[model samples]
Target: MKSVYPILILALVLLSACNPKSTKQEIALGDTIQTASGLKYIYLKKGDGRKIETGCKVGAYLSLKVKDQVVWNTNKLPDSLFTYLADYSRLIKGFTEVSMLLREGDEVVAILPDSLAYGAKGAGDIIPPHSTLIYDQFKVLKVDAPKKFLSDLLYADVKERSLNAAVATFQKITEGEESENYYTDSEQLNRVWEQLSRDSLYAKAADYAVKFGELAKDDRLKYRNVLSLESMGEYLKAKDHLEILLADDPENKMMQDKMIDLCKKHRMNNK
Candidate 1:
């Protein structure tokens, strides 16, 4: 009976060795790279494109989770993805650090310690205080140079509450004739002009409205430009644009009313 038991044990050991549980399917925790700031990550797909730079506008699809529970996912949003200026101040420390290490088209799984994530205070109701975060899949879809979008430049200034900086960034973005010419054909420039008009920086917004209006071929955009200028107290410029529109469409009641209202306001202010 003792000899038979040994033989059975030996046969079982041989069978286990042949199968070996297939280690190829498993990911060893040690394989992940940990940064000095304690951000741990593993790349699922390495990108060959240009590296992301600070102030660049990045459009990405991202998913955040704690354990198996999802916290927020860009994929679930109406846009299915989000675009943001790659400023570290606006993102979790771990995410910013890992983003710097990746390029367009790269996909990664990252684990952020509490210190690099929401930290002691955490976020409102969603992430608990001092809890770690897991970015299950972050895929960079597009990387636009800082100069590609005027909104990217304007956002940095707006975030810092520096109107002067905003003006400077706008000037930097539209420095040369070549750059200005590029914007003439860009639909994104129109979107940015509209966004600026909605921003609280009235002076800057009005400036963009007038400049973009001159470049715009669409009558609707030109009308918005006049309205934006008027809102910023640039009555003379607004009136000039209104007159031009009224010439093209002599009986446009909306334009006529705007012109009449501007004249009334001018007389009232002078009186």
Candidate 2:
């Protein structure tokens, strides 16, 4: 009997070693559904609003945890929600899977296996290797069309960079891409540039102004870039841009007056 017992115990140990299904016990607590992609989630509440789809611009509030430690909490930020285009390739596998199943006002708590979250390498300084991420809360707050989303993001929100990325996506849908161009053609590029400058987002305005100048090789866009730089108090850089403009057209009175004003500011800044 003792010999048989030893054989049985050894068999159980080997079976457990060969099979990793037992690891699910760690995340099986509470009422949770293990999705097809291995995302384990508990639906805290069901939403009655708009459904999420491929191009839906989404907003959500999240509290991410690793074991007992919190890695991210939206409640601590000035705005309680983070906005993103619901293009899953740009997001972690766990967030993508859960997001696809959500609608506006839906909330869920999810546990992402090590393979789905950060994989073996983990995120720098934020996640550890072979970590299981726990989303204590993920609440879908809003969903809107791309244009409406861009409008709200630009004039109302601080996520100007997201606006840029979303705009680039309109031109091409490459996986894991973020771009600052924010326009598909020269005409739209000018509109976005003018809008940013109107809103006093001069740094991004200057960035696009330079991009427009490079693409069209237009002196007017170059002058727009100079104006944006001047607005940002980059007097020295603005003066350099003015000098380039002057080199091209030394006989223009308007550009000459602009250069003189800029040089005085540059000299004062140097002093």
Candidate 3:
């Protein structure tokens, strides 16, 4: 029995040697690559060599399209890796697999075949089954781990760029308003203000508002600043600021409600 075991093992080794090691195969337009009931990738590069990994962080901008219609697009905006792989188990098997294989600054387009994409079930109301999807991805950046990835403009360098953009956007919107752009309810103006305020860009917010004589002139923008201060845990200052605004604009219902809420929250947190 022992001698027979050696022969059996030898035979199995010979059988395994019959198949070659799996490798990547490149394809061009009008080409089809077959897979073994799973996802496959085709990597393109500007230079020679290839990058392959089991798991890595990729900073990229992606535009997803189904057939001829545009579905989702980040359009050159910087997006981090964690945004896609927050829950590994929940993501489609193909997306998880392909993403894991990507490296930093590596851009490639993927053709996710139906079986590896939505499959028979399909993505409800959007992606359909037996459908081919084209993903134009450009890997603008990469990181070692998900935690190390930067998505929001919270980084010192990124924050600087965002501040500049915010300032520019604010000036452009306020250019047309003589009294106050805030009263105009301009979406562009509101968006720039909201982002600047939400990110605690208080000084930048104040500078832009004060430059055009817009901050002191508009009650709404002043209220936004008050809310910004409150969010930063400057409770007493925020409340005082709100009170001053209320004294001037007593009929402002929004300001009144906000003041009430901020003071209540401040009291509860202190208690």
Cα lDDT of candidate 3 equals: 0.56
Q: In model 1, which runs have C-alpha deviations exceeding 4 angstroms? A: 1-30, 148-271
RMSD of 1: 13.5
Using lDDT as the measure, name the better of candidate 1 and candidate 3.
1
Candidate of highest TM-score: 1
Given candidate 1, what's the lDDT at residue 215? 50
Residue 81 Cα positional deviation in candidate 3, in Å, after optimal superposition = 7.6
For all predictions, the C-alpha RMSD in Å is 13.5, 14.5, 14.5
Better of 2 and 3 by TM-score: 2
What is candidate 2's lDDT per residue for 1-271, written digit by digit as tens? 7789989999999998889885455422256888777888987887888888766778899999987799888886658888766752258887887888889988889899988888989999889899999999888999875332222233332234544563454434222343232223344445556778888989877876776577556567788889999999998898898888889899989989988888999889889
Clashes of 1: 0
TM-score between model 1 and native? 0.48
How far does residue 63 in candidate 3 sit from its true spot (Å)? Answer: 1.6
Q: What are the models' TM-scores?
A: 0.48, 0.47, 0.36
Count of backbone clashes for each model? 0, 0, 0
lDDT of 2: 0.74
Candidate 2 displacement at residue 247 in angstroms: 16
